[model samples]
Target chain A: MPEPIDFYFDFSSPYSYVAANLIDALADRHIRSVTWRPILLGPVFEVSGNRPLNAQPMKGDYMRHDVPRLCRRHGIPFAWPEPFPIATVAAARAVYALWDQDAEQAIRFAKAVFRAYFANGRNIGETDGVLAVAADEGIDAAALGQAIQDPAIKARTKAAVDHAIKLKVCGAPFFLVDEEPFWGVDRLPLMDEWMARGGW
Target chain B: MPEPIDFYFDFSSPYSYVAANLIDALADRHIRSVTWRPILLGPVFEVSGNRPLNAQPMKGDYMRHDVPRLCRRHGIPFAWPEPFPIATVAAARAVYALWDQDAEQAIRFAKAVFRAYFANGRNIGETDGVLAVAADEGIDAAALGQAIQDPAIKARTKAAVDHAIKLKVCGAPFFLVDEEPFWGVDRLPLMDEWMARGGW
Candidate 1:
């Protein structure tokens, strides 16, 4: 058995999507597996005073240049999703719906949300967007939509965000392998190495 | 001649030194060289709300794991400087003094300071340690010491810090490659590729 690496992610972050793309390979190694703990990144930024990269000219410049190039390196096409930082509330609710019934399905929806925002520039805040992805996952879209409105699911997702803050997560795609948190996607190589040394 | 890339650096920044080590080789084919812009990361942080990696536990852990490994890749030894975020006011002043008289000497001394503080746990903030590095670059220790205390040099360094704040550099080791600012060392490959393709 391998250590379950907990990943704190969000659809609003391009880095999270990039991290999602490589997560399967990470899990397949048998050295570690990902526990996708989707959190709202907005609160993380609020307390930490971090704005979106698009908000700062310097950081924005790096994002436009570096992120697409990074995606290109991974042989993935990329673009900024429209309605940046789309309301992840609905997406979060759907994630909770699949938390137990179907884990792979949950991850699929998560990836879909990320791709819609970062790669396709779609508005994930729209119910239709979330439902379309849910339908594609073979889940009952209407039921999923209703479940998304549940207070318990809302609380669950918010608690994850609170837990992320307690864990000191300041960025998206934060990975914790054996309680050691790696914050940025750029640190993946090191995370891979550390997991390997841990008998991955 | 390649247009000179402005490298905004802070003496206490390990990433800046690591990036600087490769700046030359990466820019070999470019028409512009590098113009070392000594800036204070502290002021940049004051405006942007980014603290030292060590100050932010989660981000700090990521840096500790990722950077030492990158240093190893660059064939540089690794260690976290003791008393992290050692004052660079004095060190910055010394570099400003030597900036015009000897850009190469100034760069060497700045790098030595980074290595000493960030790799060897030595305090470049103090007079003796920085002077020791200056002597290694064949500079007069006494003259350099006097330069450190010069009001003009100190004021110039202050201005540099303020300038970085205005430029919106939120972190250490930001660079401007052909007028496009890249905030982290990880952005180098893309910036280089752009320069290769005339993206600059």
Candidate 2:
């Protein structure tokens, strides 16, 4: 079997939300599984000397228009979150916490968190909001609440971000197919072709 | 008739080079024409608080890998030009100079300049290099060389850049389909859909 595709994402990135929604089907087509690794963009952006998209001068404006249009194109449910690009440490830790117990459940939790923040504008940056999203996904909310604060889980999330940085991941929704990197939701088609052609 | 697509591009940008190579064929498929407006990124970067892709930290590295992959994917001829992200004012001025004499020829001049810099590794940022590329296109060498230095041609290129800034063009290969903006070569697919469906 081929190596599972490595999917790195930040919870607060809307483009990540789009990729999270679409990646499974993409993987399914190639008979590949996915390894969902949640990362925080804060540290990554600092290392890369990049700012948040919404904080950039003209790009911020372009993203504001582009995100909604992308959602409409993909038929993904979306509403721009209030106080966008929130601190996603809580959400990332929560996924790591879930991963320690159940990988499938963790994927569900990650998708739910994305939908809660981007689709419902539920601000998953806070522990309380993320817990609520976990509960809605039929997860044990109390366990997740406690797990996010667990020292081990927090370290796991930190290590994941460090790994992404080490890999030179510059943005959310970054993918690695056997160590070939592809960034952005826009790269999905290209990635699909890459997988289909077994690398060009 | 539907409105023509406005293509804003910088000659030094690799992605813009890709778009410049493909955009005409894309337009032809939809019974559309493109208006290729050459603009310099230096002023746009200043106004947008942006840096060149090759100057950015991790993004620069990503771009180096991504450009050749994209060119191979699209079957476009490409070679990374040394001294990339060069000052393109001379090339921009040359396009404008050609525009004043012949609009269609200006578009040809623009494409040839991109090919010279990206495919042939010519240093198109220099007046002599640009004039040489123009001459290869059967343009009058001395006339085109003098035209590039014309104060009016220089002002025209500057004004075009200013106009792009006024339109909030944040990057190279930005497009406007009836005033709805799309940025990047990646957006060409979306722009095609938008034009096909008459916007979403």
Candidate 3:
């Protein structure tokens, strides 16, 4: 059987939010599933010397205009969150914690967190926001709170980020299919073609 | 009549090479013409605090892999040119020179320059290389050489770069349609849709 597509993302990324909303349907059409792996961009940025999309000068301005237009094109809801690019450690850890218990529920929670931050403008940078999104997903908020603080979950999230860095995952919404890397939400169509044609 | 699509590109960019090969056709599909404006990214990068894609850490590696994959997908010939990301001033100035004399030949010269550097590993950073490409395009090499050195042509090139900076064109393969901005070759699909639907 073909392996599931590896989907890596962070909560602080606007493009990731768009890719997250679309990857599943693309995968489903090809009779494939996605393994949603949450990661922190902090360490990845440190290694790559890359800054958040909203932090650069002209590129930041371009992204601000481009992201909304992209979201509109895809019929995805998006708004620039306040205090943009908040720490995503809390959100990443929560996903890792839930992942250990229920993989499907973890994906649902991740989706909720993305929608909360990007669509609803809720900051998912802090523990409170993470738990709030979790609760809304019908996840046990207190258990999630404890799990986020659990050293094991924190280490798992860190390890995942380290793995991403090792794989040179420089951007969020990066994907690995058949060990081929595809980055950016804009790559979704190419990735779809790659899956359909089995590489060229 | 629809305003011509403003295609801003630099010779040093790989994505620009790919986009340059495809954009005219995309424009033709929408019954639009393209104004191929060659601008140096040096000043724009200075304003944006941006570095070349190959100068970064992991992102550079990703670009190296991505560019070839994209070329293959589009059936465009590509090879990582020796001394990649060379100074494009001479090439830009030559384009301006050819443009004033013959618009169609100027575009043919630009496309040849892109093909020269990207497909055949030719170095287009020097005046001689630019002249050779111009000559290959059946342009008068000696006349083109004199024009490239003309103070008026130099100023025109510089002014074009300034105008791009003013428009916040922070990257190559950037497009401005109906005064709306789209950046990156990945944005080509979106640009097509925007032109088709007349914006959303």
Candidate 4:
């Protein structure tokens, strides 16, 4: 592996789920390494002046048509999880809690959240659904939620968003390999080449 | 059509070309309407702090893998247009200027610009190239450039960016139907559905 890959994802993004499914395969074949990073999107948006894609008439129009086709093409399960545009605050915080303990489980929790929102039509912002996601990952939901609520963990999650702003990130489903940041799932191939060229 | 579908686009983006090509076909089948728009992406990035996909490492990785595959799947001609990241100022300005005189010509000019950058590997920001693009669309390139540079036109272009920010848009190849926004070409199908539902 030339360098380890850093994947900065948010639980609320459908494209992030699509990207997550391919990360391992990408790492194994291209860089031979990968890291899971779940960050809060709210702060990133604040700094970037971006609201949810649905809030923008044109962008929301695109997502309705494109996402499902991608899911079908990838052979991955997908749907517009209910309560269109579920809040991601709690979900992002939970990810902050899961980071250090186990990376694989973090991915599991992340995918479950994606499945909940984009595929299953569940409200990810609520306690029960999120806890259900954690439990599905075999995580101690109560404990993890407790851990996340810790002031330090909460602050760290905020910092992630702040960092994303400082880094000038524009949208969800972003990736970075060796300091080079790739912004969307659509940019996957470009990142691969940069890696093949040994990711500058 | 319940009402005219407002299509938001930047002449500098190749994805818009890809979307524009077949979008008409899809709209015809779904009985939707499309109104072309020309917006400036540079200003959108300026306010949003969003960098190109290649600038983000992870996103760049994804792009390396996905873009070519998408091009192949869509049967749309594509390549990494040279001046890898060309300055799109003039390209966008030209389309905006032409829009006032002939909207269809504006679309043609936009496509020609994409073909130049993505297919011919030309520099879109260059004056000569931009003029050539106008000529290709049977318009007076020099005249168009001068017209867009006028105070009112310049302000109008800037206003479009401001409006996009107000709507919380940070990226290109955007579309809006019935006041709903979709951000990328990938979202065209979703736009189609929304338009269909609106009786477009």
Top-scoring candidate (DockQ): 3
True contacts kept of each: 0.26, 0.79, 0.91, 0.02
Quality of model 2 by C-alpha lDDT: 0.90
In model 4, state the lDDT of residue A197.
69
The regions of model 2 sitting more than 4 angstroms off are none
DockQ of 2: 0.83
> For residues A109-131, what per-residue lDDT tens digits would candidate 1 score against the true structure?
78877776777767788778888
* Candidate 4: stretches off by over 4 Å: B1-200
Q: Which residue segments of model 3 deviate by more than 4 Å?
A: none
What is model 3's C-alpha RMSD? 0.9
Higher-scoring candidate on lDDT, 2 or 3: 3
Clashes of each: 9, 0, 0, 56
DockQ of all models, two decimals each: 0.31, 0.83, 0.89, 0.09
Ranking by lDDT: 3, 2, 1, 4
Q: Show pairs that collide, candidate 2.
A: none
Q: Per-residue lDDT of A1-200 in model 2, one digit per residue for the tens?
A: 99999999999898999999999999999999999998888899888888888988999999999999999988999999998879999988988888868999999889988998898879887899999999899999998888888888887888889989999999898999999999999989889999999888
lDDT of each: 0.77, 0.90, 0.91, 0.70
TM-score for all models, in order of appearance: 0.81, 0.98, 0.98, 0.59
After superposition, the stretches of candidate 1 with alpha carbons farther than 4 Å from their true spots are A1-5, A25-34, A46-79, A126-128, A193-200, B20-33, B60-75, B127-129, B151-168, B192-200
Pairs that collide in candidate 3 are: none
Q: Hey, what RMSD does candidate 2 come out at? A: 1.1
- Tens digit per residue, CA lDDT, model 3, B1-30: 788999999999999999998998899999
Candidate 3's TM-score reads 0.98
